[model samples]
Target: MTAEEYQEDILDHMEHMEAETMPDVNSIDIQTEIQWFMRPYLLDFLVEAHAAFQLLPETLFLAVNLLDRYCSRRVVYKRHYQLVGCAALLIAAKYGDRKERVPTVRELKSMCCSLYDDEMFTQMEWHVLQTLNWVIGHPTVDSFLQIALSEVTYDAEVEHMAWYISEIALFHKEFVSVRPSVLARSALALARCVLSRSQARQSEWAGTYDPVVVLNLSNHLYQPSQVLSRKYASMHLSAVSTTVEEFLQRQAQIARRNITPPTPPALENQKPDADGYLTPSTPQKSHYDAVMQHGCLTPPITPDNEFGASNFAKNVLPRLYPVTPTSAPQEAPQQQPQQYSYQPYLQPRLAQ
Candidate 1:
């Protein structure tokens, strides 16, 4: 058989391998500290590292696949979370990338701000390989995308747009269970529509994937990684992210235009004068002027309120330009504790 035929046969076989080895759809269910939302932050780290090392696109997806598979089996602590990622990248680089391009453990260590020592990374790498049973030949979404792109007329924009959409899906937990082939096809269709390319070719493509399912999956692309968007904003990628953003913005404007404006109530009295000009009734004070006069609309200030004139004179002014010779310098106010949307990064771990 020819090389293309061999490659196609391998990919066809990978569909089965993916089903057997893919991480659990609700894999984070087993994780105690790692919530679903925090996955994006970790993904952002991986993207930056992937770009910095100049690794192949397939290597990045393979690394994430390994990381998720490893996490699926292991109990990863928060401190060791990023260490797992470093190990996954290292293993993926060794597996897929050339020997010269593979990142050294020291390079990954430095990328991680030296939080993990050389021995720790080595241990983690060995641990990940053992957990995965050395099954690292999983076909990623990018592999499927290549085949789809090849089947149709080639456009650099479509390739970049489809890849950008697929990368965004990596941050989403919902798409984890969906097959990469499905994602690749849906992303290509959406990219074509965004670029206003012909859908004549897609008529054949739709028969394979359900239109409802493809439409639903397409909705998830609305949210993408900001870091990845900026990465694709370069001239090299044809700035497809900006194109998608403009498409969404134009859709929003069209939706706004369709909204019916509220109608004014009909007048009861006949009020037109000699010149036939129906003059508006009485002039009213501008709401903005009223606001300026009233200040910020706080409750009528009592003597104790900080912003009250008397209190400002007595306390605020002195603090602003303190003339105190030495009045036992006032204690600074304690700030309220900040509330974070997600768990904070690793606190210093004690040496074992």
Candidate 2:
């Protein structure tokens, strides 16, 4: 079971869940709740972009996840959403596949139909890296599978099952909806499910097949649904089963869309700086892994000057325009009236 094959199942589950669970856009609060929809929108965009461009899906998914998490923790002003989204993608591309080039602002603008300004994108790329503390190193899907393989009994069949399930789990972003930690647990849960099942022992298989952590992870992923659902009293271990159905439906939609007809636009090499807006530069790598491990808010890029601010300025600041302070028009000084010029009705004289 290669990662590719496993990704398919994961994707299937994701599609179903998204359709069933995606909150109605109309119900969302535009001012306060836009981030929730923005994350999914960005995720959807990336999924389409990866297919259209033949880029890696894992990289795109991981990047979008990181972006979502970052936004959840920090406030992204309305104007900066595109910048933040692109920055997250840039970071993901660097960390997930170091060899891949960060997409240029022009290229990304083309991808996004020129919705974002180049300087804004560049600034966001830097800001996200700063907040993340340049820590991209973390236990990825490959690492988690490696751990699972080492722990399980050494059987070729078990190894194959683990590989198959883990890869498939990647495609199902729902399994990892909470975070990397949840993702690791769900993959292990899936692997264990496959390995523990037996053809002869039907009841035993049924008992062992239920995923413990994936349900918990699913709860973490869909707290809104779990909390609000009238059907379930307290969302327990059984919720994943119910949610899994929803996930697969959404995944199917994505798959169907993937299979649909193509639209053609002549490809053009994006010339780097067409506009006078600051030239786009590659984003600096941040220590995201260290920041996550530490669990601190003031990760290198905080407003304070503790962590190097020079990098922040270079990476995160919008291009500065020279403000040549219009010399305040020189004002003429008014003369003061002499104290004795105006006499009061009853003025008192000093005695000699």
Candidate 3:
């Protein structure tokens, strides 16, 4: 069997494995102490951490895969949530990356502001490996995307937009149980619609997706993760993030036009009531909107930052995490171990 001929078999096997290893998003309801709202904070932290190491994009996806699968199966303490993320990242890096690029125990500890020790990482890693029965080879969404992308004419905007949309899914629970193949296809489809490439060659590679699911994802994107947007907005990415924002803005305008509310007759045209005060015209636009209409909605372009990921360590790290070290008995630095629901860490952190 030639490699090309065997491709179908390979994909079929991966889909089967995905069904087995996929995390149950509903598994969060089983936990007593944690809620769904806490996930985005940890995921944001993971995104920044992933960028700092400059690891492969697939490494980040696999790490998230491990985190979700382990959390679904184990009764994790709130304190251990962040630790689990760190271990997942470590396992992913070691599994797929060059040894030199893998983060060290000390580096991981520092990243956590010294909240966890080497032993904790080791134990958690072993626990994760055991819970999943050492099944770390499940194909990630990125893999499925590569298969689809290979079938299509390459467009960097489409590629980056697809990735940007996929990363946005990581922060939301709605996407947790979505099949990797489905998510990849849906993201590609949505990317095509957003980039206005739908009439071009999209039908060749986008395949087909659930319209309801695709629309749901599209509506949910009115607000997107600023961090992921920045990651893909770099000069090399063709600033696909900006491309998406503009596309969505146009969509919003079209939606408004289609729904065109009764243009309230001009104030002068309306007959005044017996009470005498002129009735207010259609709900007046908010002052905020008035100001935004005058060129403030879109940020001015700056010299294109080559890769926003690199800025996470130097610029964003300090703002996002103000390390408050606890006093150690020995000569170590103080570490403020944040609770699992660390609200301070919730602010969107990423590059431009």
Return the top candidate by lDDT: 3
Write model 1 residue lDDT over 162-189, tens digit each, in one string: 8888788788887777777777777777
By TM-score, rank the candidates, best first. 3, 1, 2
TM-score of each: 0.71, 0.41, 0.71
lDDT of 3 by residue, 1-352 (tens): 6776877898899889999889987786698766778888888888888888988878988999999998888888888899999999999999998888899888889999999888998998898999999999878878888887777578878878777788888888888888888888888888888877753253553486656667768876767777776777788878987887787788779989999877766665444343343334756332122112323322222334422556564564323222466787787689999867545657777998
lDDT of 2 by residue, 242-333 (tens): 44446556767898999997888866854433223342265634323232223332234554443457656568652233245567899899
Rank by lDDT, descending? 3, 1, 2
Per-residue lDDT for 140 in model 3? 84
**Model 1 regions lying over 4 Å from their true place:** 1-8, 200-207, 210-213, 261-352
TM-score of 1: 0.71
Taking all chains together, the TM-score of candidate 3 against the true structure is 0.71
Q: What's the C-alpha lDDT at position 90 in model 3?
A: 94
Worst 10 residues of 1 by lDDT: 285-294
Off by over 4 Å in 3: 199-206, 261-352
How big is the positional error of residue 265 in model 2, measured in Å on the Cα after superposition?
64
